[model samples]
Target: MLTHPTLNQLHALGLHGMAKAFVDIQASGDAASLGHAEWLALLLEREASLRHDKRLSARLRYAKLRQQACVEDIDYRTPRGLDRALFAQLAEGSWIDAHANLLICGPAGVGKSWLASALGNKACRDNRTVLYQRVPRLFSELALARGDGRHQRLLRALGRVDLLILDDWGLEPLDAAARHDLLEILEDRYGRRSTIVTSQLPVDQWHALIGDPTYADAVLDRLVHNAHRLELSGESLRRVRAQQAARTA
Candidate 1:
């Protein structure tokens, strides 16, 4: 058993995970005990795991989440009106598989964006493609893309993602172009993809935010209908944390 030649062959064939596992098992003196079949199985498992990890890393990078949050780290004790059972069900990702929508509404600093990001993170972990964009910034980018000839391409990319997180929604009223763009984006995704929207304004106020009765009706029809709603309420978590820190200091 010439180990160097075998390792070189594995590396040359791009079996990096198996190659590293071989080295580790050889160093651990496990190679002498394990049969050839067992050794092959272990190597294959390591390679699959490595590939899965790489894919997850790429998905997370593509997600571009606004916060480093996870479902496991969610503060259930924070006195917000989060429904644990419903959220648990949501975390299983059935809603996403069904191409449904999630709406999270709360005042500023109430963790609306954070909760949305957590769901986005979970979707990435579940091997689903996700894209995170703040509504205002996304509209701005869409406007610029129109001038740069990337408008349709960008929309197509947005449409293709498995889950799209639109954070900070209704931060500013949409202008005519923005309103049209919103409808276009939503219409493209309607019943075909899942979307998570976080907003300071309630769903009732969304129509006014869009500014045009026609486009507003179209946008809300696509977004509000068949969407799961989570309305959070409490004092700002930021302020509470700052007060606690000051007292401790």
Candidate 2:
């Protein structure tokens, strides 16, 4: 067999994975023992794996998650009131498929943002599109978009993602423009896509934070209903870790 010619053809066809697999198999001592069918199957499998990895890489890059967290790395032993069973179910991503929302509420340093990022990471792994944005920054960007006439285009992009993660919600009360923009984004995504929100404030206070009775009701109606809640309460993890380091030193 003309190995170099075969390799050239594979490379020309952009089958990089298959070409690499072919080289590896050629180097193996048992290459002659495999049947033709087995060799073809191995090449196809490598090609599929390579494509999957490329797709996942693109999804993660687009997500721009706030934290590099994964569900597998979650600290269940931290006593932060994270429900293992519920999170495990959520990790399976059925809720995302159903277009439901997830609310992670806790005080500062209780891993609210981290948990939301972990879920976003999981969604990317599940082959779902995701976008992460801090609430304050998102509003600022939206305001800028409005001024530059990119407002509707930006909102449409936000709405199209499979999972939109809003981290650090309720950092401050929303002004009129922010309130209206938020409603627009949520309304666009209301029944078509899932959202994960992380907040230092509890859900009940969200209405007040939104600031207008009419907009508040409309926003909450889209977000709070059909949402799963994770209420975490504990001492700050940062404080605990620093104390442990001090004791070790």
All candidates: TM-score: 0.98, 0.97
- Candidate 2 local lDDT, 151-171, one digit each (tens): 989999999999999999999
Q: What's the alpha carbon RMSD for model 1?
A: 0.9
Runs in model 2 with CA error above 4 Å?
A: none
**Each prediction's whole-model lDDT (CA):** 0.93, 0.94
Q: Mind giving the per-residue lDDT tens digits that candidate 1 earns over 128-224?
A: 9999998889999999999999999999999999999999998888899898888888999999999999998999999888899989889999999
